[model samples]
Target: MANHDTETTEKLEKFGKRLKELRKAKGYENYEQFAFKNNISRSQYGRYEKGQDIRFSSICKVLKALDVTFEEFFKGFD
Candidate 1:
């Protein structure tokens, strides 16, 4: 259970890093600006970037905002 928890945390962190990278690549220097533009809650988006857990539907919304497909988002992730 401990190992699983650790793995989950690591994955979440990686996801957050990837999200930030994509946001920068998309020309959004600030997460708040991105969130506001995309109609996402700025606070929640900040939490997500800080490696918090997010729902699948919310992730889908984020992906749409980022203009990335699931495959593209998860491309280099294990």
Candidate 2:
């Protein structure tokens, strides 16, 4: 059970880092700018970037705003 939890946490962290990288790649240095531009809540998006729990719908929204397909987002996934 503990191992499963740890694995989930690690995956979240990796996803968050990748998300941040994608945002930066899209020319968003400030998270606030990204959130505002993408119509996401700044604080909530911040939590997502910090590897906090987020809804799948929210993830989809973010990905859509980034112009990334689900396949592209999960590319190189473990």
Candidate 3:
């Protein structure tokens, strides 16, 4: 079970890093800027970008802001 937790954490962190890079590529400066535009808090956005095990609902909100699906967002990681 511990190993499973680690695997999930790794994936979450990878997702976070990927999200950060994509946002940067789109010309967003930082989590604060993205969050502001998306109407979320900077701290919350930072948590998602920094790996806090993002919830499905949060992902939905992010998808709306970034205009990308999870498949497309994660394809680069593959």
Best-fitting candidate, scored by lDDT: 1
> Model 1 segments beyond 4 Å from truth?
1-4
Question: Pairing residues by index, what is the TM-score of model 3?
Answer: 0.85
TM-scores for every candidate against the unseen true structure: 0.93, 0.92, 0.85
lDDT of 2 at 63: 97
Residue-by-residue lDDT tens digits, candidate 2, 3-78? 3488899888888898999999999997889999889999989988877787999999999999999899999989
Which stretches of model 3 miss by more than 4 angstroms? 1-4, 76-78
Off by over 4 Å in 2: 1-4
Candidate 3 residue-wise lDDT, 8-67, digit = tens = 888888988988987898899888988998898789889889877677898888877888
Best by TM-score: 1
Candidate 3 displacement at residue 9 in angstroms? 1.0
**C-alpha RMSD values across all candidates:** 2.7, 2.8, 2.8
lDDT of each: 0.93, 0.89, 0.82
